[model samples]
Target: MGRLEIKSYEKIKEFLSEEHVGRIASIDENGYPQIIPMNFAFVNDSIYMHSYTRGEKLDNILRNPKTGFEVDRELEFLPSYFSHPTDASQADTLYISVVIKGKAVIVEDDDEKTLALNGLMKKYQPEGNYIPIKNNDLVLDEVAVIKIVPESIKGKYKIGQHLRTDSRLVLAKKILKRNSPTSRQTLKVMGFEETPDGLKMVDEPVW
Candidate 1:
């Protein structure tokens, strides 16, 4: 909940890779928030997303590059622990979230665009057959690519950071032993490890 107190930026970076599909929030003409689910590549400590030739998100970024993105994972029911009426405090909910704020700049040069697209492919296509990205494929004179230069990046992992060592061990065991969707992800979810590469989280790097 508070400002990020996690280990290192590498941890945050890994988390971003773990959670590749984040929502990009841009400001509409009337100052409303426009969020679109996007597959992003975390490289060089920055995030990049591709876009079609035209759209509202592109317009908003062109008008104002400042934007915010968020991705989160909740692991509350790892044990299905429900608070008893005798307990006064609320039940526990373990979770983690990442927030990034930045100014987006559309890649202007064709070479840069191609490189960005390749980076994106490498991120998602670690195992898929290689398909060279040509400027003609997507990046044309009209198509737009947004490189999100993060002004600020943060991660809040509320998975009992304050819990005593014993409680943490208990949680870890639960994560390791359980078989549900959230629990099965404990190793990667708890920062103990990362999901393997070649995971298809995005189509291409647009920016």
Candidate 2:
């Protein structure tokens, strides 16, 4: 119900690193925005993504480097009845999101490309089953690494953190009762800890 801005830079970076997919927007020849959802890695204060050597998104970026990128995780969906039995307007969702305005460029340096690709592999495949990437690898010729240097970043979240203590506890219990796959993580995000007694508010929401 309240607009809670996430002001912590560390938390924003954590969220971005954990989120599986991010949407990147690029302006087309006709000035329309073309958006694509792809896997990403956050490394060295920039966003890195690997793609085929040629595509519409690459074309757009070459024409105009300005871009927008976003990553978000939807934690829970609270129905209208959670607040009011008959008013649909009371429905709300819990989520954490980050947005960035940046300039994108196709990475040209071999060592940087190797670093970015290896960073992505580390994020997506932490098991260490594959060989590390090298600058001189022939595979580099087939893949294009896009780097986004962020000009501005903003993060926001909503999880009943603005509610009174008692009201927030009640909402947490309701979420637990529903017991969806994301319930525990959602409760954790809302600052609840599980104990033998039940869920307890141990701290403020992390983001």
Candidate 3:
């Protein structure tokens, strides 16, 4: 199936909100690729993440500001046996992925740091039970906030968007029979809308 791209800002933001972790890639001093997983917050069309005051990531960023970040959510696994009975190679997983090419800047301003930390708290702990971050907090000195301003952002979803109507219907029925949460989510991503009569397929799937 052909890959589907998401170009809508709102849709991209929604997908980013649904994902909590992202992989960030940078170049180390040796000119080697350094990739690490990080908890991130998406706000104001920028990505914010925190780290210790000193780390390999910080060192890499100091040497080079250009970086790549990616976030992805796996929907469901489609086994080849379920479709192409003879070819295991046909097996694949459905997922939504977003990639960002951006410049990373260390946040030194107290107000900006506080705002970024607040954004992180709101994202991971909407329960609002923790103490609010303050500029005077000693921990602020120990932590480093990094903000990524994206030069380009691209999103892709592999959820059977290229499937023909009849094939899509069969897949939807299979997904329903499976009845797992992931299956249900996959159905939604595949543009299967529930109607009074039955599940209706849309011409375009939601990426």
Candidate 4:
């Protein structure tokens, strides 16, 4: 019934690893937030991303090292009608997210740069069709690898975990009938399983 925190480091890492992209925020010269969607790899307790040697985001990071990074998945949207027909205030959404407050630096060391680039490749191209990055690779000169060292990491998720059993059962049935792309997975995370009889709460909530 309280705010559920994802206390499992493994689960947090797994979520970050599987997420396709994350948004990084930096303070611009004018003190406005500049947020960019980036392809990144979570490795060594840090976030690594590659960019052009020159860019607004890179410039912002260089000027102001404090940064924020976030990754989230919107699983399902519960209609207001699920709880109330016309009140329209009972709607809720299910989601999982990780937020980070960190310091960013442009990696200058070739060895660490190589490792970060290779880590990015392993995440984006897991099929193993390309060569591993090397310290002396020519492309390293053209690309800038930004490494974010997190000062704080917070993970949170909501998937009907706070509802009473009767309320949750009703919600699960509605979600199943809605049958959105993520409905089944959402139900599973909420600990529901389909059975010959009907929907059953067979396990504890995963997130």
How do the candidates rank by TM-score, highest first? 2, 4, 3, 1
Candidate 2 residue-wise lDDT, 49-97, digit = tens: 9999999999999999999999999999998888898999999999999
**Superposition TM-score, candidate 4 onto the true structure:** 0.94
Provide the overall lDDT of each model, using Cα atoms, as 2-decimal numbers.
0.70, 0.93, 0.86, 0.92
What TM-score do all the candidates reach, one by one? 0.77, 0.96, 0.90, 0.94
> What lDDT is reached at residue 149 by model 2?
99
- For residue 206, what is the lDDT in candidate 3? 54
Superposed model 2: Cα runs more than 4 Å off? 1-3
Candidate 4, residue 114: how far the Cα is off, in Å:
1.6
lDDT at 104, model 2: 100
User: In what order do the candidates fall by lDDT, top score first?
Assistant: 2, 4, 3, 1
lDDT of 3: 0.86
- Model 4, stretches more than 4 Å misplaced? none
| Top candidate by lDDT | 2
Candidate 1: minimum summed lDDT over ten consecutive residues — where? 198-207
